[model samples]
Target: MTTASTQVVLSLTERMPTTRRYLMCEPRHFTVEYVINPWMDPTTPVSTELAVAQWTAMKETYESLGHTVETIEPVDGLPDMVFSANSGTVIDGRVLGARFRAPQRSAEADLYRRWFLDAGYRDVTMPSRVNEAEGDLAWTGQILLAGTGYRTDPAAHAEAQEALGVPVVSLQLVDPRYYHLDVALVVLTEATPTRQAHIAYYPEAFSPGTQRVLARLFPDAILATDADAACLGLNAVSDGRNVVIAQESTHLIAELRAHGYTPHPVDISELRKSGGGPKCCTMELRG
Candidate 1:
């Protein structure tokens, strides 16, 4: 109903400029090496060549828009390493390392920590609790919107809040299909004093209480259609102006465009076999 928050979201899509910087990992060695998520089935065949080609196309898409695409060296045996967004999240020049729930991904934490350290990020906090970094926790301006009940532990929310000096809102994920918060919720615009934040999410991913909380907090949020949600529509990467989303999420693409956003759809179907999408493959280096 034409609320102030709705107005802010509309203004954001109309006025916010594109972000020029991003960090990604080439899927050169990407494959469904193991079953870490609901989508990943070790028995099913995966094409590593196709995954790499699609990822390269995505990187080139960003570069064509005049954005800087920095990459991390892919380590052998870490198939999920291609999902760079799960590594860690950066805020205020400080990095918070992800403590993965699975052993396969836990070792990735150390590599990401080392990378951040070498990259000159001094205040890197190695989390003790099980948190998949940006996959579970995302920053809407300074406030953290965290998800739990699948990969990230609820206690880690407090730890992140203490480390980042920001308020953290914990949302409980109920569906295993949308394990990570980034897969269920997409932060479209950051909150500020004069403008409200905007987000898009699949309601079925969260518990009833969490759904109520989300509805109350973001009354203007775009509720994703069931078909779009199944296609991992919420797993989209937005640069405030341009939103790179999954090609199969047709409903979501139309929804974003109706809200004045420029939707850049890309085919990452090969990587989706491992439960990773466009947002999963990209991480924004917030300074």
Candidate 2:
């Protein structure tokens, strides 16, 4: 007999791949210089050289898969700049810039805001409330799924809605290890005119209410295993069909395949020392 999850997978139609534009920053200065999230540890040694090599390979993988990859220059002192997903949220050509919660990452907000303005984004709005941009905000093609209870202030949810002109659904993350919504949930197939949205998430990362909300929103959503979640497997980037994920997430990779999605695993273990994975390094540029 097929499991409920497997049955859900079998019931789904074929998935289609779309070419996406992504913004990535090279891990030139990536290191565990400070500890913020549970994954970070300053005492542990980090290899900047290895980080760069791994990041380069991930970027190349996106390009090889018919996606456009753009880069932003990395600043020396900001080691976490490599995880550009925290920079801002972009949708329909409008940009809502991030306001970091941690003082160490405060400077990144202005830099990313400047990049948006420089790129000719006239509808850019710098958020006043503490919001980590795409790190806590995810666009599901139908609505903005916002996360709080950790990095992003709940007040920012309304602010994001106003700035981006979209409906926002707020979810509270309970686990510090899954502080960011992107770390706990990955949108598998964004809602389109012909299809509803689909996602894969780690239920334990969310509060009970949030888990129930997620289930109601995505009844057929793939539930990730504990081992995969521990490896930051839910921190993935999906272009409707192909999923770029961490190489360490073996079970999640198999689940993606079973669900008719291609999983491209990249080893960013060095960057994971600072609490980031494939999705953390990629910022989608939607227009």
The candidate that achieves the highest TM-score relative to the unseen native structure: 2
Candidate 1 TM-score, true structure as reference:
0.94
Worst 10 residues of 1 by lDDT: 11-20
Clashes of each: 0, 0
For candidate 2, lDDT tens digit of each residue in 1-287? 89978765764556888899999999998889888899998999999999999999999999999999988999999999999999889999999999999999999989988888888889999889999999999998898999998899999999999999999999999999999999999998999898899899999989999999999999989999999899999999999888999999999999888888989999978989999999999999999
Clashes of 2: 0
Report clash pairs, candidate 2: none
Highest lDDT model number: 2
Clash list (residue pairs), candidate 1: none
Clashes of 1: 0
- Regions of candidate 1 where Cα sits further than 4 Å from its true position: 1-13
- How do the predictions measure up, each by TM-score? 0.94, 0.96
Candidate 2 lDDT? 0.92
